[model samples]
Target: MEILTGSHERAVTTMALDGRLDALEAGQLRGILSETIERGDVNIAIDLSAVDFVDSAGLAALVKGMKDARQAGGDVKLVAPKSADAMRVFELTRFDRVFEMASELSSLVEKW
Candidate 1:
């Protein structure tokens, strides 16, 4: 998986993810989020539009990132997950309820 980071005016850091989010990539996700949080960028938007697949470990990594962000007085939001298989994982895990989701980055930025 590849993670690209950028910031918005609302102090929201957007991480655009590409490729599969599996066990091997889970740690990279965590590290990216950790670095963002440590930089005092607590509000995050994860752009999963390019992510075709995600496994249990990837979900765990997302959960961990959200928890860490919240603890820092911020939050993590999911955006534009176009893959059906990837969305199914979130649905099956009921993570759809746990994390705030948006169809576009603009919506999340506006809400935040």
Candidate 2:
């Protein structure tokens, strides 16, 4: 997996993930989110539109990030996954209702 990071004026950290988000990449993603929050940028926009797949470990990492960010007085907004398989994971797990999601990154960033 490839992770690209960027920042917004609203103190939101944007992370775009390319490729599959699975077990092997879960730890890395968790660490990145932790570091971003540690740096005081707790509002995060995670663009999953480019991601091809997402497994349970990947979802766990995202949940951890969301929880940590919320506790830090911010939130983690997800850019709705373009892949049906990835989207299904969120739906099946009922995480779609738990997270604030948008189809576009710009939309989430604007909300932040």
Candidate 3:
């Protein structure tokens, strides 16, 4: 899995998540996101359009990222999920509300 990260603006950072996100890969993403958020980022947009799969661990990592960001006085938003499996997980977990779900990366970043 490749988690490509870059800043689109001073306040917004984008992570293009690709490949599978499960227990084995979740930790890598977790570390990357935590670092990015901790570095004074106010808005985050995760481009999951390249993600092929996501499991419970992946969901947990995302939740942790969101929680950490909000707790830091910021916010994290999820762009449209590419994998149907990931979509199902989000829907089943009712994360559609916990995280501001957006169909496009631009919309998510524009919110803040």
Q: Per-model C-alpha lDDT, please?
A: 0.91, 0.94, 0.83
| Model 3 TM-score on a 0 to 1 scale | 0.91
Clashing pairs in 3: none
| Per-residue accuracy of model 3 over 25-110 as CA lDDT, tens digit each | 99998998888877787577888877777889999999999989888887778886867876887888888778887888887777
Model 2, residue pairs in steric clash: none
lDDT of 1 by residue, 18-100 (tens): 88999999999998889889989999999998899999999999999999999999999998579998888999989999999
In candidate 1, where is summed lDDT lowest over 10 consecutive residues?
Answer: 79-88
Q: What is the TM-score of each candidate against the true structure?
A: 0.96, 0.98, 0.91
Which has the greatest lDDT? 2
Q: Note the residue pairs that clash in candidate 1.
A: none
The order by descending TM-score is 2, 1, 3
Model 2 residue 39 lDDT score: 90
Give a tens-digit lDDT track for model 2, residues 40-76: 9999999999998999999999999999999999999
Q: What is residue 96's positional error in candidate 1, in angstroms?
A: 0.5
